[model samples]
Target chain A: DAGVTQSPTHLIKTRGQQVTLRCSPKSGHDTVSWYQQALGQGPQFIFQYYEEEERQRGNFPDRFSGHQFPNYSSELNVNALLLGDSALYLCASSLDRLAAYNEQFFGPGTRLTVL
Target chain B: AQSVTQLDSQVPVFEEAPVELRCNYSSSVSVYLFWYVQYPNQGLQLLLKYLSGSTLVESINGFEAEFNKSQTSFHLRKPSVHISDTAEYFCAVHETSGSRLTFGEGTQLTVNP
Candidate 1:
């Protein structure tokens, strides 16, 4: 089965601009979560989407938002981006809703560069 | 809130040598632990996980992690490494009630042949 897939493998945006990254969940998965991985650091959870609504969010600011479509695809939008917003944005899909036991399948991720 | 800490930022070793990567976590509630490996320009791949049962969990690639509740640590080790094993290793923890994961800073393993 095809695993999670993300669009626009790379993106470049200027400060004060907004960008949207897309992701298609793995086959048979419903929940989608977004993460931000800065250089030399592990990924940090941005937020999770279940049932088309954002269920949980990390310590990220309000500028970071996401949406889960009915087809289980997701889009992460970052508004008014700053230079620090440059990082690798990853999307992961899981079959479970809240259980931590469900393993997540990740996409190759979209590398965002804020210039 | 949960958080993970990987003590080593970089580990270099010769091929076929053993290696250990340390990881520690802090959580107020019960949590599940996981180790993921990321090769260059690739997504994170599940190495192994510790939910319950045995404290030690092994992966097919000869890597294993032992969960220590008292110490709040889950350190990963491999008996023998290969050049292909070089990657960034991440330690993550997730609360049973939440689907989110808290990850460590990651340890870069460089296995030279």
Candidate 2:
């Protein structure tokens, strides 16, 4: 079975532009979480979606938003991107919250470079 | 709010030598701890996690982490290392009531020949 998969392995955008990255969760999983990994730093959680609704969110601003479709795929949208927004965007999938263990499986991630 | 701190930013050690990566977290509520490893050009992979039960958890790859509630720490250790073990290690935590994970700055482990 395929693990989590992300689209557009790499992307480049100038400031004030908007970018959208996509991800497909692992088979049999229903939860998707997005993270931002800056150069030389660990990933910081952006948000998580369950049943097409956002269940949890991090300290990110309103410029960062996401959507989860019924098929369990997710899309992360960043508007008015800033230079600091340039980073690797990772998508992780896991089983539902009711499960005993929620070990997340991650995708290769989409590299977004905002100039 | 939960936060994680990986004490070492970089650690260099000879192959087959033992190593330890320190991690500490702060959370007001009960939380789950995790350790993730990232290789070049790869996403974060779960190395091990601590939810409940025994405080000591081991990974199939010989890596283990012990959760000390009193100390508010989860330290990763391996009896011996290999060159292929070189990678970035991250410590993360999430409240038991939530799903969002807070990560540390990360520790770079270099196992030399």
Candidate 3:
């Protein structure tokens, strides 16, 4: 079975520009979540999507948004990005809403570089 | 709000030696704890997790984490480290009521042969 997949592998954008990152959920999984990992830091939760709607969100601002398609794939869009937004954008998928026993499977993240 | 703290930023141990990486979390509600390992240039992979039943959880790779509720800590330990075990280890906590996870700054483990 395929694990989570994300693209493009890397990107470069200037401040105030927008970018969209994509993710394909793991086989048999329905929930998708996005995270941002800054250099030398752990991954921070961005938001989660289930059944084509956002189910939960972290402390990120409105500039960060996401969508879940019917097939459980997801897209994370960052608008008006700041230089600080340069980081590794990670995508994770789980069987369902992350219950007690469910573990998330992550993809090779898309590295975003903001100039 | 939930938060995690990993006491060590980097840890180096001789191969075959036992190792322990410290983690502590604070949450107002009951939470699920997890340990994830990320190899260089790779995605984070779940090593083990503590959900409800067992205070001690073991990963397939012989790593284990013991959850100490009284101390609000979940420290990952391995009886004998290998050079292949060198990677970044992250501690995360997800509240039972929510799906969002709060993570600690990772600990980079380097096993020297």
Clashes (backbone N, CA, C under 3 Å), per candidate, total 0, 0, 0
The candidate 2 chain A region of ten consecutive residues with least summed lDDT is: A95-104
Compute the interface RMSD for each candidate structure.
1.1, 1.4, 1.2
lDDT by residue (tens digit), candidate 3, A33-58: 99999999999999999899999998
- Score residue A5 of candidate 1 by CA lDDT: 97
Task: Give the 10-residue window scoring lowest on summed lDDT in candidate 3 chain B.
Answer: B94-103
Candidate 3 lDDT score at position A64: 99
> Per-residue lDDT tens digits of candidate 2, residues A1-115?
9999999999999999999999999999999999999999889999999999999888999999999999999999999999999999999999985954588899999999887
Model 3 over residues B2-104: C-alpha lDDT tens digits?
8999999999999999999999999999999999999988889989999878899999999999999999999999999999999999999988878787899
Task: Compute each candidate's TM-score over C-alphas.
Answer: 0.98, 0.97, 0.97
- Model 1 chain B worst lDDT run, 10 consecutive residues: B94-103
* Displacement of the residue B96 alpha carbon in candidate 3, Å: 1.1
Q: How many pairs in model 2 have backbone atoms within 3 A of each other, for residues 3 or more apart or on separate chains, i.e. clashes?
A: 0
DockQ of each: 0.84, 0.72, 0.76
The digit string of per-residue lDDT tens for model 2 on B1-113 reads 87899999999999999999999999999999999999999998999999999999999999999999999999999999999999999999978877888899999999999
Candidate 1 residue lDDT tens string, A62-98: 9999888999899999999999999999999999744
Per DockQ, the best of the predicted structures is 1
Cα distance off (Å), candidate 2, residue A105: 1.1
Model 3, chain B only, scores a TM-score of 0.98
